[model samples]
Target: MNVINKLKETAVSVFPVMVIVLLLGLTVVPLDKYLLIRFVFGGILLILGLTIFLVGIDLGIQPMGERCGAELTRKRSLSLLLICAFVIGFIVTAAEPDIQVFGSQVRGLFSFVNKNVFTFVIAAGVGIFITIGLLRTVLNISIKWVLFILYAILFGVMIFCPQSFIGIAFDSGGATTGPMTVPFIMALGLGVSSVRSDDENSFGLTGICSIGPIMAVLLYSLYLKSQGNFDSSSVVQISETAEAVAAGSPLSQIFGPFEEISGEVLRDSVISIMPLFGLFILFQAFLLKMTARQVAKIVIGFIYSFIGLTVFLIGVHGGFSQVGSELGFALGSKALSNGGIWFVLLIAVGLVFGAVIVCAEPAVWVLSEQVESVSGGTITRKLLLVFLAIGTAIAICLALIRSVAGFDLKWILIPGYGLSMLLMIFCPSMFSGIAFDSGGVASGPLTSTFVLSFTLGAACVGANGNDSFGVIALVAMMPLIAIQIMGIMFKLKQKKGGQK
Candidate 1:
């Protein structure tokens, strides 16, 4: 029954994307039959995989993270807490499927980047910042000051990094906070905050953690720039790869990627979970005195999480990505051939895609539920979802505009982030934290994968050589502004009610 309920919910979240794609094929896009079939198959897998994954998160990941957090913090050793937090953040991030997916894309596009090095650098960034976030929570520092200082430094560093690296760096921030990282990290934050009896602080850990990767990648990009003599000739345009995939593979070749990816995903999933499992065991032995039954349940939960994660990765990588690429190429081609109406059509499609695809993101649901729970239902899940969808929809529109117009990303990003930081002044502090965290959560696995692939394809064809790296960055950013706006509204409503 629980599994069935989860399936129904997951289906609702996922089916809109499938419906939109089918509609596109029937009308404007006209996808290849085989590619469309693969997309449908992948959607089925996505619904199923996401159902199981959510169940596993509830059963194992959240509980375990909360327990570990609370117990670790109870020890009252700041040094120990910071060290453990860093390790947890690093291990979870290193194992994150989203980062792995992003890293693979990066490596494919740029010959100079080593996937392992990139992943490691990103993981280190999350680790360092997770430590900083915890320190802020423990010390009760202001989130606004912390955010202002970090981003100011980020912008300073951004000026020094290569323009190409900027988009990838910002996208890295979003990708690091995917399904594998968000639940555990949010739960862990909740647990830590519980120890301090402070609910507001629970919301900002992921926000702070998101900043780490952008800074780290920017700094790493500077290092790469310093090296100077790399071959630029080997760079593979994302559109080329998307075009190849969009062109359609043989019937035999279609499932072949699935077969190959399943094995690889299974391996990666195990590796991803092991460090956390090992940490749990270490705590179990020394700190987390659990009964045999409790331990058994958690062990089973880990197994479910591992299996679900593997399946989810396969569904995403092998299935939906091709369709996204294909759709983008088709749209891009249309815009090239037929200008005015096609551009409007593309923006409309982007709005719908941005709004719906976010629904399918597991981390978005987790964060929404957290917001509702933490606010004691003052902020309903449905309300937050609406805000997120609107924010995401707007983000996609901007991305489409950028791709179509060939503007520098800084034009959108500088104002977007500036508005977010500025809004922190009037927005309730709790909402400020929630808003920043939502910014991270809103850009999860699907944004990094499908939405990103789509943008790359569009940029390849539509913009005549404009870079396609910043869509995810924009997707990650818009929610900060949106949610903070919601916060200000909520405050005004409260004031109105008091006056009445």
Candidate 2:
């Protein structure tokens, strides 16, 4: 029954993307037979793998995170809470596939940013911020004030960080809060808040925690920039021929690419999960010991999570990467050659594509469900989806425009975030938290894989791919304003009801 429901959910998420690709193939961009076949196969794997992965999260990871959070809070020791928070945040983020993907892409473009070092810096940021978030909940600090101060510091740091690092830094905040991190971190937040009688305190930890990576990456970038050690070349070239690699036999073609990725993903997953598992065991042994049956169930859950993650990563790398890159390249190259009308059409397609793709993000579903539950259905999943979709569409349109026109990312990010922060003054506190968190949630695996590839393709043709790095950052930023507008409407409605 659980599997059946998850399958249905996954289908709903993936179907629109398949339809969009088919439309593009028929109308604007016709794919070669090999690329088309790979896409179809990849889409199938995405649905299957995502369904299994989400189920595993529910059965295993979420429960364990909640228990860990609950047990840590139960101890009533500040030092223990901070240490555990840092450790858990770092470990969970280090294993995140989105972060890994983003790091690889950046390394491929700029050889100076070592992938391992980059990932570790982002992980450390999440860890420290998570510690701060936990402290806020325990001490009853206002999320709004915390966010205002942190973002102020973030913008100040941005002045020193190189232009190349700015977009990547903000994008890291979104990417790290992906499938593995969101459910567990959110569940952990709930567990910490559960101890508090106040419902208001139940929300905002994830929102605050999301800020950590942005600041962490920005600070690291500033440090690197200060050392004057890296190349400042803006003329990076993407190979068109790279997208046309020959396909193998049908079976081998479908399964071949996964061979190397499977081993790497499996190793990363094991390394990412074992520490948390070991920590849980230690905590159970010494602090909040559970019954034997409870331990057995959680252990089984961990196994399911590990298997699901391995399969999911294989599907993403094997099925999605090449096709996404190729499609973007094809569309982008065409748009560049055929100017005027074709440029407008390309932008329109980008907007529609962005709108639809958000529905397919697995993390978006988790977030929408949690929001509805927390808001007592005042913010329905459908309503939240609309706001997110619209925001994503706008963000993608801007990204496409920027790729074509060669605008500085700071121009968009500065005013866009300024408006978002301004909205917080008028927005409800809970809505403010959800809005900021949604910015991160909306840019999950699908954005990293498909939308980003599409943007890079456009960047390759329209400009040097230097501008492409910021597309995901734009996807992450726009939702804050869109959702906050919705929050204002909700507040108005509530006030009207009160007056009545």
Candidate 3:
């Protein structure tokens, strides 16, 4: 059953890209003889790996989140629970493979920055936001106030930071809350919500969990500006290699200069994960007094998560990153040759990415289901999916325009966020929660790996290096604007009906 579910997930995730490739037809493209082999093999590997990962997550991470959440509530001690929140936030984020992926890619873009420094900074940022999220949950804080404060700080930092760093900072914000962080954080939220008195309180955990990474990335942008080569610009290579260049096969690439460092990351992740496991075990044994079966199941799930995450990281670092960078560079180079060509290319790629995201985004299916359930059939999965596709397509269009036209990303984001916030003021609290949450969930792996690559590629060709960095950030930002617009509509609907 577990394997089957994962297979379904992988098929759902990878099918659109496969169809696109099939439609493109290998005969038309001019590339290496190994191109089809590389893509097919890579696709199969990803499907299996992601399948294995989801299964592992089902068996492990989810339970850990639930156990910890329940245990935190059981403790009934606010101080201890808050401390757990901080440690949990920091550890899980520190273990995040996505952060490392972004770090590696960003480091390659500029000669002056070190990957390790960037990785640590992004992780630290997650840690900070994780703490803030937990506090918000406890205090029952409105989402808008916190976002305003966070973005205000981000804007202030942008003023002092190198212009190049601003985009990277926002991009970092988007990446940090990816597949790894989302599941754990959402599960933790579910765990925390288990004890809540109200449905709204319990249900919005995933929504709140989304914001931490964005704020963290923005904060890190400040550091990138202060140290390192803020003045330097990365070359708009004719083709941007996907995040990592993947000079060779997985074994060769993973075992190279990274061999020494790989061990450290592995060790750190293990050390961090252990305490959480141990805590769960302790809670289960002492307080919950679970039978052997529950303990056994939780333990199995934990092991599964550990292994899946390891494989996921290996795949990401081994080749996926470079592929993203290379593909982006190529697309950007090709698209910018002429205005007519650029517009066509932008719309075409936008369609590809929009379709790809609906299937490949880990969070999209989850969010679709959430919407369906939350709206009690008013928002069917199909309806939610269609709207998301349309809205995301628009966002991609804007992002591409920013890339191709060299428009300030802030122009789009500032107004978009402003409108989202304004909606929050009048929208039903539930819609506001969902709107904020959608911001994080929309820009998942598909966005980071491909859509982001396409935007960066075009931006690098179309604008300055500083501008190239913000495409993903904008991709992450506009969804907040879009979903909230829907939220306002939904709130107004209730008001018209005279519902409480």
Candidate 4:
């Protein structure tokens, strides 16, 4: 029954993309038969892989996070809690599939930035911010004030940071809170807040944690810019074609990219996941000391997580990446050639794509579920999903406009964030946290892998690589406003209900 439910959920999530792709293939962009076959096969794998991966998260990762968080808070040792938060934050983020994929894309663009170093810096940023988030909860600090102060610091720092690095820095924040990190961090937040008497504190830890990577990356970008050891060149290249083999095996042709990407993904997954697993075991021995049954369940959950994530990565890299880039390239080139009608068509496609793609993000489901549960059914999943879809659609429209107009990202971000911060002042306290966190949640693996590739393809039409980098940041940003608007509506409704 559980397996069937998971399959149903995966299918619902994946259906929109499949429909969109088919529509494009039949209409504007006729994909090569071979590529189309690969894409279809990849989509199948994505459904299966995501189903298994989400199940594993429910069984293993979420439980581990909650247990560890509750245990840590029970210890009542501030130093120990901080250390554990930092370690968990760093390890989980370093192991995040979204972060790994985004890092590879960044490295492909700018070979000068060492991939390992870049990934570690982002992970360190997550770790530090998570530690701060934990402290905020323990200290009973207001999330709105913390966010206001942090954004003030962030925007101030942005003045000194290089323009080229700004988009990538904000994108890092969204990418960090993906499938691997969201369930755990959110569970941890819930667990930690369980110790508190107030319900409000339960919700904001993830929101605060999301801010860390942006600040960290911006600071690092400043350091890199200062050193004067970076490349600003923008190259527009498509996916590499695999060599034809005379053996002519059909299976070999289908699985060629899978074989290539699987090995690297497997190696990276092990290296990334093992440390966190090992740390959990140590914590169990020294701190948690659960029974044999509990230990065994978690261990099994870890195995499932590993298998699920591996399959998911294979599907994404082998199936989605090439097709997305190809579609974007075709659409972008067409729009460039036929300006008036084609441009309008591109915007329409982007808006629809943005709305549909958010539905497919695994972390988005987790977030919506959390919000609905935390709000005691006052905020329905359907409502939140609608708002998120609308927000993402607007974001995509803005990204397309920016790509076509060749505007600086600051023109959008400065005002976008400024309005969000102002909204925070007016929104209910809980909504402020949820709104900010939704920004990170809405821009998950799907946006990073597919929508981002799509935007980059568009940017390459007549723009630099840096132009598209901000698209994900925009996708991440708009949700802050949309959700906060929902919050305002909720507050008004509550007041009206009180008068009755």
For TM-score, the strongest prediction is 1
lDDT of 2 by residue, 87-187 (tens): 88988788776677788877876767789999999999999999998898899887778888988898998988877778888888888877667877877
Estimate, for each residue in 1-500, the C-alpha lDDT of model 1 and write its tens digit: 28887788789888988999899987877877777777888788888888778887787778888898898889999999999989888988898766777898788778889899999999999999999998998898988889999999999999888888899999999988877788888888888888999987878889999999999999999998888823567567644745344333576556766786788878877877887788889989998898999888888888887778777778887888878877877887788778889888888888988988888888887788778888899999878888888999999988877876688899999999999999999998888888888889888877777887777667777663547588889999999988889999999999999999
Each prediction's RMSD over C-alphas, in Å, is 2.2, 2.3, 4.8, 2.7
List the candidate 1 regions with Cα displacement exceeding 4 Å.
Answer: 229-238, 241-254, 464-466
Best of the two (3, 4) by TM-score? 4
- Model 4 Cα shift for residue 316 (angstroms): 1.5
Question: Between the candidate structures 1 and 2, which one is better when assessed by TM-score?
Answer: 1
Per-residue lDDT of model 4, residues 70-140, tens digit only: 88999999899999899889988888767877788777766667788889999999999899888988898
Which candidate number maximizes lDDT?
1
Worst 10 residues of 3 by lDDT: 27-36
Error of 3 at 89 (Å): 0.8
Model 2 whole-model lDDT (C-alpha atoms): 0.79
Stretches of candidate 4 exceeding 4 Å from the true structure = 108-112, 230-251, 465-468
Ranking by lDDT: 1, 4, 2, 3
Q: How do the residues 233-288 of candidate 3 rate in per-residue lDDT, one tens digit apiece?
A: 54323333333324777554444524534576466446545755765766676665
Local distance difference test, each candidate = 0.84, 0.79, 0.61, 0.80
TM-scores for candidates 1 onward, in order? 0.95, 0.93, 0.80, 0.93
Error at 128, model 2, angstroms: 1.0
* CA lDDT for candidate 4: 0.80
The candidate with the higher lDDT, 2 or 4, is: 4
